[model samples]
Target chain A: MITATPRKDLLLMGIFTLAVLTMPIWLAPIGASYPDLLQRFAIFGIFAIGFNILFGLTGYLSFGHAAFLGVGSYTAVWSFKLLSMSVVPAVIFGVITSGLFAVVIGYISLRRSGIYFSILTLAFAQMSYNLAYSVLTPITNGETGLQLSLNDPRALDSLVGVTPTSGIPPTNFFGIEMSGYSGFYFCAILMIIGFYISMRIFRSPFGMMLRAVKSNSNRMSYTGLNMRPYTLTAFVISGMYAGLAGSLMAVTDPLAGAERMQWTASGEVVLMTILGGVGTLIGPVIGAGVIKYFENIFSAINENVLHGIFDFLPEILQDGAVAVLSLFVGEGWHLTLGMLFMLIVVFLPGGMVEGFTRIYSRIRNKNNKNNGEAGSVGSAEVQPGE
Target chain B: MGILEVRDVNKSFGGLKALNKVELDVEEGSVHAIIGPNGAGKSTFLNCLVGLLIPDSGSVNFNGNSLLGIKPHEINQAGVSRVFQTPEIFSDLSLLDNVVIPTLASRDGAFKLNGWKRADQDSEIIVRAEHMLEDVGLIDKRNMHAGSLSRGDKRRLELAMCLVQNPKLLLLDEPTAGMSRADTNNTIDLLKRIGERGITKVIIEHDMHVVFSLADKVSVMAQGTVIAEGSPEGIKGDPRVQEAYLGGAHL
Candidate 1:
């Protein structure tokens, strides 16, 4: 029921674009401005945004989306090997291949719903992972993973008479190399475009139908609507988003690994979506940034860094504090992530967006009370489902 | 010939018979009421007609086409809309969205890829949805979540959802299942107000007041089959119908 005006969406888009584009400037204080981490933020943000279309809108929890990500990475690497070092062909092939893969898996997996549907997807992903790791070694390159070789036919590069160097060429957009700051910017632009498309979907009739499917599928059928195609379209779209993210991963660092398709990777995106807030347009992206920040920042903290921060304290007390905190950082960062995930799930079921809305409404209410306004109580309340 | 015809429809669940040789003929532009005591196959018959339950042996013809073996949405696309007894609506959506969905379903058929356009920007559908909300006297709450409405209001919203479809036939299962006397009367008045649309309606109800006020014809069912059919007055006084209600101990 929260009506989204064009003005409101435009305003939201403006803020989102500014925030994403200025990551290097603002996130410097938090030490997350490095191009690799920034690129991860944009790429995973796209993944989570797409994942929300199916999981948040349709309420279908897929535990196997990593398969699409894996598929996209492999397809992109293959495109780079056979076609060109330019990322355009790789990204296109990645999205298209994963979309077709989604059509097949979604058609089969969607025959079931709820836990069964999740299990079916998980099974599919695990199967794909195993195949990519061992059975499909010729294409996936098995445990060593897929990477470009110096001798491989770079069709487009050769056709353009672009001589190969001794080292494998880095991926590029036309002639602009995808590395460091340039790579981060490219991924950021694509992420913004993906976010815009997601915003349009959330405001579309098709999106309403997806929500209807989530709200009451029985009533939807009786009201003369089919639930399958709507959900399938959402699933395929989401898979394509994962594919896009995967292709970006390859673009940034021309290597496709089997680990990218692992179940844990799929679970990571789920955690990001839930941690940010499901169904909200910007929540998943925020979640993606938070998780990536934790993975990069928290894991970087070592005993020496802790000792340096606690150097002012007495020797014994400093050692005890460092020892106690060591389990929460470094290799133990997953424990911290797990704790945060549990907290978000238990207390903030609506995620960070709901928390922000609650804080915002409380501030508005206080302002209204100070102004002695009796009306406008409902005006500040925004539904998180939007 | 009636607009809807059900002949010798039989549905059984294992050892229990839910419907047995059920025959119903709903004339065009008529309000046909089926009244029965608990577990009298009223809801089952309605489900059979709408393809929710496939009758084991029977033919359900709507507008001269067989309703057997078709999907529920397909049946709905063929102009058959159903309202559940418990007021099944899109509770997470706004009241306006609750109405708008059905209109979109009717306009676009079962599935459409209209993602390029904004749903709220479609002035035609938005205007029609607002009009429906106004008709149900809930235009002020159009922005409120459907889940937040009171019980009586949810029922009204459900009716608006069905009515917006402009279906050829409307099947209602206990349109007034739980309500105060005042709310029940309001529903009766609302049904009468919409009677001008002349949409054929098959309503299964236990409320006799609702039956007498709206039904052009009444069918009384007992056990798993219809025992008597006539005008509401004729069916009310029929000894066989009375026996079915009270086991012949009185009346």
Candidate 2:
């Protein structure tokens, strides 16, 4: 019982699929054709989408989502180490493991709300981070991360009699190597499935209930809907999404680090969700891409690239221009991101999606005026014709 | 026995007792209004019954089920709905959504997981919610964000949200606290119509006109105690009830 008609949903999904499939071609002109950045975009997009379900809908500001991501990474990396090098087992293992982890964390943290719940989650995440960095070093392999060793017998791979081309076993789907375009495609497909499921949840009864919880937990309870199960369900689902994203990261680059469990990593996804649009379906994904884009491209913009862009100008003027702009890009990309975040928060509290919709409605209104129609742009709140 | 029974309920905040040895028996299918001056603890007593607060020692039974120490949603599932003093509706959601959420909750039980199912396609709840909105006279503004609604409209929307549940007991705290004479009369009319459904109601109101007009049974609370209990006419005529109202009742 999705809110949108099946036809509309299918059409939207088709457009999304086409865009993702042709990313290599479409993104090439922008110099983002590389598989690594693209895979990262898909992976973090999935992460932020899941985070949005819990934060955007339920209003539970979990300060420890990265614990689940770290758990998923460790689980997948462990699967690669112990089981076969096939990503199938790794993904399955990761998602399930993180979901269980979320159940425990959610159950405890949900006992309280507001900043108290946040502190509880932060405590749990900090505990995990500390354990992973120290006592659980054997399991997480400490700061160096759990990496695949060349000497260890991959029992499932050996027993299944699959031979690798190199000494360092490459993760694969049967014989197809999970590297380069193939790996990006695999992650991209998962990202689409993740997006579809997120859209379904957003349109579902559960999603409404979650939003109700956000609006008024006490009211929802008085309405005879226990918000605990709804919040917990949302939390677990989002945790698994984070887990899937982590597993995808492992699928592309086979390593798990303790730093992935840090509160800062959890904060990063929150930033991405808020920066795009908190509750909107596509906002978090777009936000993730924007953040990732800044992290990669903006940081890669060295003095040389700045100089090249200003090469037409005099040499002294080029140097001065590069110095002035350098604060926003290159090693200071985070400063640009922080400024952008502030601007969005102040001017567009609804985030980037709201900005786009606002612009879109303005265009539509102008077109309507051109066509000489009655101006029914009544409410300040944006509601599309639908 | 009454549908909702409260016995020997006592609640204290630090040293101050909000509800002290309070007792109430609300007849089934009747409007029971509890009137009190400021701080008469009418809200506190209601909170105890609705699981918002746990009393030091008391028994609150609704339909033979003990409601004490239970969750608010559990109490709601046990056939009790409450309208807040200031109309606690989902301001972010549309008016239709605000009503449908409760309708779904009432039909689906306290904690059923329906995350994957589409909400708008559920014609049964949607239709019921629509009709409920019409009942409250907010059908035209159904798609509007509830936050944008006027104060009176917000109260009506909240009423629609509660009425859609069709509960055995509807607890209202000052349903007409701050409204025009017309709005107050409209709310009184709405409650009277709801009364025809034979749904038991426990209303805590300060407005004597509303209390006397709607209440089948009236109880006057003062200083955290039920000082007088009788028919509306009898309670109105009581001299001590007049004193309680005029001389700093400290409800």
**Each predicted model: what fraction of the native A–B Cα contacts (within 8 Å) does it retain?**
0.79, 0.72
TM-score of each: 0.98, 0.96
Return the clash pairs for model 1, or none. Answer: none
Off by more than 4 A, model 2:
A1-5, A378-386, B247-251
Which residue pairs overlap in candidate 2's backbone?
Answer: A1-B118, A2-B118, B39-B251, B40-B251, B41-B251
lDDT of each structure? 0.92, 0.89
Candidate 2 DockQ category?
Answer: medium
lDDT string, candidate 1, B110-211, tens digits: 999988799989999999999989998999988888998899999999999989988899988998889899999999998888888998998899889899
Best by TM-score: 1
Top candidate, metric DockQ: 1
> RMSD (Cα, Å) of candidate 1?
1.3
